[model samples]
Target: MQALGFEVLWKGKNFARLMGGLWVALRISLIAVGISLVAGVLMGALMTRKNPVVKALTRLYLETVRIMPQMVLLFLAFFGTTRWFGWNLSGETASVIVFALWGTAEMGDLVRGALESIPRHQYESAAALGLDGKQSFLYVILPQTLRRLLPQVINLVTRMIKTTSLVLMIGVVEMLKVAQQIIEANRMKVPNAAFGVYLTVLVLYFLACWPVSLLAKALEKRWS
Candidate 1:
């Protein structure tokens, strides 16, 4: 076995460049998650409405996102439609846009589930306490929705972090891309370096994602 080189990962200008790419990925994920949360909440609220048109539209949106692979969505956003619109969008922008759109659909569904899980009597009780629909939701329903929503949202964030790896395929030089570069560079000297590099990348991903998973578990335990 090759000596495990902790120092290799930490030393020099290359490490800084690798981390810079990671920051780009993190930034994209953060913006995507934020946009998705707002879009999801609004969509979830609309889903709760009694309007058939709204329900049908929301269902169609959710189903479309569900049926499509994320890579396909990325391709469609980045490559398929830009020429038709005469709009110039970069790889990172396209990635964020696709992830936000995808995440909104997912988060909206998650929010709907959490909101619906609340006992109907909670709304009734809020109404009985002289709270109007808006007030009731703002003060009562929203709080409970948040309680349930937090764990799921945390889980989604971790998923988002992992999913960002896919963006490398479209030429975004994130962590995976950096690892691929390293593997290629080392492959001549160390024939099995690709395996080692990939193993390291896997561990890095686990390091990044595990805390979010743990946080979700803790929140679930605390709230449930």
Candidate 2:
């Protein structure tokens, strides 16, 4: 085990540190995901409207998120914003902000797509049933929209989980960063620790994400 570098994980509190780091990453992503879902639903509903101002603003936001790298966004939020706005944001806070921005954009588009995918006949049918616009949306449209939206949303959860690794770049001591710390500490003693450490991180991430992925798949299958 020492030769293979697995024993290094047993030395002191290294394994516990890794678990703590994983929680940090999850906490950031889950918080951002929660914020995105609420805001994105509102943005998406607005996107379906014919308001020119809303269109322009939503397009700008969506496009900016699409064009910018997540890393650049992280740096902009963590480093640039503190200087520009004089707001002292912690790394975890900055990470949550950046990921929330990114998630909101992506989720907005997904919501818009889900909303638009509903057939015109469905609306007409709801009207034919003497349903008012609000009633129709609540009883008919919302149920269908949620069905289509949920699988994609679950998929987004997994994406966010994996992407949380990028938070390390902004000095958030997430799982990857903790792995690096462990490896760096034991470098002289375990030359091959990097591989084992990274492999463990990879496995942990896969374990974290795989169940979410499976849920998304099951949802798509059940709803398809």
Candidate 3:
């Protein structure tokens, strides 16, 4: 009986605020993903090296990230750091830092696996073509590695976007926070507003993420 259009009309301004919060979430996710990509590529390259010390360090970092829950990491970064070190970190900043760390660890592992999966003969072929270390990587190795990495990296991006919702716990006031606020304000008048608002949020997230998922699938199919 409750039409979607009616709900929209009733809470139009709140809907606009939700969009603004979504923009905040998108911005944070983008910055975190960018940092993660660069740091991850470097860490992945290091992980592939034969140096034991380098391998150990990278392994430790990867494991630590993998073992910890993201919420716990967020808390540590936002609350624990401020308490222990007297560092004034904003919720948004802490969320970015935590996500960047997590994404970097995952991406590093993906890159390492992709690089190591390259056949031994590929390296031999590159060297036989008179390619030096840098040339081999740039001209021969990296292109293929990128192909393998593209799909997985795109998937990681979607994950980061979804995970940014957790930032609300630390008072980042992203889309979920906006939704909560709207629900509270309209609880008395629009009894079913929670369903409509949350459904809208779900649709927004799906709209944002579904394209990336499709792109990943397309790339995977093409590369496969």
Candidate 4:
């Protein structure tokens, strides 16, 4: 235990770097989640429309995003897009863009699922009350759909947070990256630093995710 690099993390400089990296992860996830929620809701609503062409296009977009691995997406954003398109993007900016794209696709599917799960009777009742399409959706549909959507959104957020570790692959220096750096720096002296550093990172991820999980459960109980 003492042979591990736990002491490195306790050092002020490393701890500060760890916290800074964690904040980077948090910032990326929060912004991505926000952008994705709005885009997803609009796209998901469009997906349910009567136009076959629009539906097909939307489905294709969703499937393409779903099928691609996130690491591949990040690489494409960081390397392919920048080189091929002549777009200059910083590592953090690229990470946010890729994650936002991924989150939007996922959230759109969740929105579509929630909207579809709402019984037809609810819509019928709204129509019977002389409610127009927009009114019906705003008053009768959105509130109920929100109950289901919130938990799923929270789950997506946790996933995005966890996957932020992948940003390290592109040299983003996020939490896991900082941990790896510390381990590498101390590997010879501590001998067992790799295991301790990773264990600490795992604990940090758990700490980050647990609250969102608890929030989802609480929302479920409250809304159910």
Candidate 5:
């Protein structure tokens, strides 16, 4: 019991507090995902354009996001923006902004991939059905694009949820931050609190992510 360390959860409101912390992480990720989905779709549509200027700009944004470590982006959003722009961004807000940026880039790439995966014949078929350009896209292209993107989007959301753990470093009071607090508070009373608490944390994360993971896999299998 001491070695596994879960007993700490039996005390006070520790477990409840951990659940609240998890909600915080989920809230941030959900909000970020919402923004990313809308913006990413636009960015992805733009990416399919033939203009070199737009392509270059999108490519630059994608490469910049890929090249920069997310930790650095978090630090910049939380600290650097406050210093340079005098914006009093809270840790949670900064976490959301950073994550939204990351998710946007990721979702954009996925959308682009999904859009590109459509065969040229689909468009011609839509036209043969007497569908105009907008109707053709709305009825044919959009459905197919969404079908391809669905599984990947589920996977992306799971990644975003897990990545929310990093927000704790910026003092976002998330599950990991709560776990640390619980361990530190019980250091003397529960010598193995760290191990048990962290183990529990792992389980909580897996529980939260598992359903979505299963859905993504099922989608990939059924849709593939």
Candidate 6:
């Protein structure tokens, strides 16, 4: 048992290589999350507007992203575009783009819900207090909407982080892909390496996600 641990953990810097792959995953997820937050908030805000054209456009985006699978989107971005448009996108770039699109749709919906959930009286109260549309949204409406959105947004962050594993399908060489490589390389000698390697990957993902989950719960409790 101890020998198996040594083989998996210490053999040829396998752990270090895995950590590198994890870094790749983390970097992609973070970039995607940042883009999604900015774009999603704007999309969501537009979705709540009374303008028919804006609502229709945002709705189409939301539904398209909601209906498409992330894997398919990744393939389309990475492989299809190269064939059709001559734009050769890297796997990491494709993964980030796909995730940002998915996250935007999700975050936009959450934001829309949060914004709409604000009571009509709040708007009336803001108007009574001499607050114009901009002032009411900035000072009165946005804060409450953000408070409502916080937990769900954090949850989406965790989801995006986990979903980054799918980038492996497109040859992104993230943690899971690294794990598979390690297992294949050691299949001859360290027969039990798969268990250890995959278990380590699992623990890594759990560690990354658990704190986000806790933060979400804490925000929910504090805001409730």
Q: Which candidate's lDDT is highest?
A: 2
TM-score of each: 0.90, 0.93, 0.92, 0.94, 0.92, 0.93
Q: After superposition, how far is residue 84 of candidate 4 from its true place, in Å?
A: 1.7
RMSD of 4: 1.5
Could you tell me which 10 consecutive residues in candidate 1 have the lowest summed lDDT?
A: 3-12
* Best of the candidates, TM-score: 4
In candidate 6, what are the lDDT values of residues 1-224, reduced to their tens digit? 64454366677788899999999999999999999998887778899989999889899989988898888899999999999999989999888889998988899999899999999999999999999999998999988998988878988999899999999999899999999999888887888888888888999999888888888788778878
Report the lDDT tens digits of candidate 2 across residue range 102-123: 9999999988999899999999
Q: List the lowest-lDDT window of 10 residues for candidate 6.
A: 1-10
Candidate 4 lDDT by residue in tens digits, 107-224: 8888889999999999999999999999999898888987879877887889999999899888898988888788888777786878777888888888888988898888889889
Compared to the true structure, candidate 3 yields what TM-score? 0.92
Candidate models: Cα lDDT each: 0.82, 0.90, 0.88, 0.87, 0.89, 0.89
Candidate 6 TM-score versus the reference: 0.93
Provide backbone clash counts, one per model.
Answer: 0, 0, 0, 0, 0, 0
Q: Which stretches of candidate 5 lie over 4 Å from their true place?
A: 217-224
Q: Residue-wise lDDT of candidate 1 within 20-139, one digit each (tens)?
A: 767778888889989999999888888888899999999999999879998998888888768678667888999999899889998999888888999999999999999999999888
Clashing pairs in 3: none
1 or 3, greater by TM-score: 3
93-179: candidate 5 lDDT, tens digit per residue: 998998898889888999899989999999999899899988987889977897889878988888899999999888899999999
